[model samples]
Target chain A: MTPEPSPSAPTAAPPVPSTRPAATLQRRLFLVGSLLVAGLALSVVAFGDLGEDLVYFWDPSQMAAAGEDAVGATIRLGGVVKAGTVQWQPDANSLKFIVTDGKVEVPVEATGAPPQMFREGIGVVVEGTLTKSGVFTSDRLMVKHSNEYKAPEGEMSAEERKTLYTTVEEL
Target chain B: MNEVAEPVATGVITGGWSYIWAAYGVTWAALLLFLGRALLLSRAPDPEPE
Candidate 1:
């Protein structure tokens, strides 16, 4: 037989179920969704600026073909340095050279000590703007080295170097 | 345009490796911090029963 309840005892109500789990899950989902949206927005803005600033690499022939459209825009030009066309002024710290990709040649003027490996007949990438006059004013120059590492051949003839600074400067 | 535009000479960018390194460092630090925070939260103790 069950014991009888005391007259003085107070009745206790049933405990309410907790909603903490659902609230915690909702908070997590909100945080994750917000982060995703924010990241997407940030990348869109970053890429937009990058697309404008990042210049395209082009060879001498391609740059020539680009014509007036190539002027005033920053571009990275890649070509082999034409032999016998390098003019360096030590006092002025100015260097001039003609970059040729066989078919076409472009004159480049840069102000800085050439890198250790810089020389004639080597591939190089010059980063700068092409003026309306057609001279590439390079601020940064990078020499490209081949894996084979063969020594440079003899000097090119004066006839081969005939198409030099004069031709490109006229552009 | 009839008039030829003058080229804007940009200065040579030298010694820029420091900035590149700093950017990489900050990115890694942020990633690590986020991972640590997530792990800490996942291991946090549940609330005591009322």
Candidate 2:
């Protein structure tokens, strides 16, 4: 007969019930589910914050209709720059202009030089608050160019062209 | 950027379609990658029994 097994001999360790393959799969599924739920929660919060920051683009006519209720709220105003309404005061570092969308006009006051692409008859978007005084106080102005790269119609007037060239020379 | 006393002359801003295209392309690509990963995981072979 085989020699009696020694009483103190070491035996293979028993397999852990909790460490089975099924248990591992369950743990993995729980982790993935938790991650998905966390991601969805994060996405919802981000979208909610974005909703507050999304300024709606409104034309002058729309703004006019909004009346006093629109005051003090930030908005993106889009319209064509009204010709012969631009007044630039270099001394005061202020530029005032009127934006019109044919149906209505809004006066805009800004504290810096207009964008290089800014000119009469061009479309623009101004970001600012509409004051109770019915003036749009713009802090940021962007020129809206068409997707088609076509030459602008008409040439600048002699006086305006001279002023532009002189300004360029100074720079 | 310095605040110029008078408006300066400059060329028209152009050629930004590439950026727009890239933005949309990257978004779709990421979505596709995520979908592919999910499908692959779902089809993965079950672990062998102990």
Candidate 3:
């Protein structure tokens, strides 16, 4: 019968080998470990010393409530300069003012000349340590100006005119 | 006009480019290391069954 079957019919082709690489347990562990280490390194670099280096900004009222904890610690006190409390001593090169939050007032003795914009009733930020005698001894002072701008509504007072025209030494 | 001109910023920020380059260097180093690791892992042969 002509050797029966012709042996030409092909059986099911062998399954094609997968081409994509499979992730091994070791590789997965390495990936996880690399990510964990990177995250830890970034976190340590960013947040280390955050607490110790942070300088707290407090108003007079908040500072007063802090009591002894605030004493001798470097802090930034922000408040409006109390009117009639500004005393500039040109000979002494010292500026003494009282910062008030409308409820509490803190006396500040700052070394060096004040900024041109610094005046009574203006917002200011003083940075330094609080003395045990309840006075803030500041080495740096900054004037804070409001974002709102409007044209002058009235004539300038003599005092204001003098400040605008006079130099620090003349003041 | 006698009006005072609007105040303009006269100061220039100096020496910040080094920090930017340093940040890019770190990022690129990490990326290249990761890429090398991935390529090496992909080309490695799987162990034959014992």
Candidate 4:
């Protein structure tokens, strides 16, 4: 049975439920969303400056398509060294060759010695400027080769051994 | 002897696994830490009104 209220007792209102947890969660979500947006903006700004200093690699056909805009700008031209176009002068220390992407051919003139793996029909990336005369003058030449490894079937022949160490002069 | 020798393997990249594992470990550790913080926050006791 319920007890009767005393005449001298003071009456009070019930307590209200707290909304602090939901408010805290909403504030945290807003903070995280703002940080994500700011991070994306910062990345966009950083990538905008990447084109100014980073060198671009282009194929011979792309170079031809770029036309006069490609001249005087330092770029890395990637293509295969055309066969029967390699001319190396040891006495003058000059190396000249033609790079082709099967559709377009670009003549390249490079100074100093090339890499050991540099040969005809091999992929190469030459870094330099293109002249008005349509010759790519390169100071840096890099050879591109596959990373595959295969076991020899048998002993290497004498001729194969000789060609392996041969320089461009003997090509 | 005229027997052919076995060819040695070359150019296989074997040195970077440690770096890859370390990166994954750090990422998982950070994710778990954030998850634990979220769980604790969800189960936290409400503040008493003054």
Best by TM-score: 4
Interface RMSD of each: 14.7, 10.7, 16.2, 15.8
Ranking by lDDT: 2, 4, 1, 3
Could you give the CAPRI-style class of model 3? Answer: incorrect
User: Tens digit of lDDT per residue, candidate 1, span A92-156?
Assistant: 77888899999999999998877766777888899998998889999899888779844335576
**RMSD of every prediction:** 18.4, 16.3, 18.0, 17.1
Better of 2 and 4 by TM-score: 4
Which digits, one per residue and each the tens of the lDDT, describe model 4 over residues A1-171?
644334333354323234478877888999999999999999987877876556468999999999999999999999998876787766777788899999999999998878766777888999999999999999999888879666455688767767776865476
Q: Give stretches of model 3 more than 4 Å off.
A: A1-56, A153-171, B1-50
What's the lDDT for all of these models?
Answer: 0.79, 0.81, 0.79, 0.81
- Residues A1-171 of candidate 2 have per-residue lDDT tens digits of 654344343376444576789998999999999999999999988776875456468989888998987899888899998876777777887778889999899999988877667877788899999998899999898888889875456677777878999999999
Clashing pairs in 2: none
Q: Count the backbone clashes (under 3 Å) in each candidate.
A: 0, 0, 0, 0
Worst 10 residues of 2 chain B by lDDT: B1-10
Q: What does DockQ give for each predicted structure?
A: 0.07, 0.10, 0.04, 0.04
